[model samples]
Target: MLQQRFFSATSSASKYYKITLRRSPIGLSKDHRASAQTLGLFKLHQTSYQPANASTAGTILKLKELLQVENVDSIPTKEQLQANKPDRGYQVIGKKI
Candidate 1:
């Protein structure tokens, strides 16, 4: 599956699944919790990406009750996602010896 994704991603038209956890799955069934984990969602309001494919579609279906999903033209790179994160209001300088 990785190899297939790798090759397909070389094309300019790659797509992604923009999945966000809209509600906590904390008190849900075990199946719900496992599906949430499968989608890389473990916290409320957390967002993650998955390749837009049939398998992901099936998983999304299983967790449809808890997720907000969309098909995206392209997945944001990690650096891009990081740039959009809220600042911690501090920066590291140097370690004290």
Candidate 2:
């Protein structure tokens, strides 16, 4: 039998992280856009959350290289989400991103 230790499916200690795209790489290149798209991040001020696992970590890491990554406990409220939007001047209202 084979053994695995990186991340177990039966584990119950998984955490969630909030990933946001602060800046837009519109004029950067195709590669950057593809990277953001792969992480489900396209438009600026867009946010997404994922389990704190190796796969998620890898995606976050990739985005971090270009955008920003922040670990959050729970999903942000509607107001909270809207407050962090670009129109709000990208303010740090609800929480840091």
Candidate 3:
């Protein structure tokens, strides 16, 4: 029993959930809004990484309607997250002095 517990605890790599806010929380119940906030989703299309645990699972379930979730192998750093965004495609050629 002790060996099994130890193996289980150490063998499995930690997983992360990539959660994106697909819908607005406006007009929803306070509980829904609070759940979204707890998940670190404050704006539309905002993505946040959360550990795959009971509390995080509960929060995702509570606001599942407004969120899109995917299991990610690793969590992304702030720089990586920013880098994933597409360029606006427009550049300012000249500015008034």
Q: State every prediction's TM-score relative to the real structure.
A: 0.65, 0.53, 0.70
Q: Give the TM-score (vs. native) of candidate 3.
A: 0.70
Candidate with more favorable, higher TM-score: 1 or 3: 3
lDDT of each: 0.86, 0.71, 0.89
Best by lDDT: 3
Which residues of candidate 1, in runs, are more than 4 Å off? 1-14, 82-97
| Sliding window of 10 residues with minimal summed lDDT for model 3 | 5-14
Residues 1-97 of candidate 3 have per-residue lDDT tens digits of: 9988765754355698999999999999898998899999999999899998989998998888889999888987889978999887888999999
Q: Write the per-residue lDDT of candidate 2 for residues 1-97, one digit (tens) a residue.
A: 2455653455455377777889887786787678778778878888777677787777666557566676666776899967877763455558656
lDDT-best of 2 and 3? 3
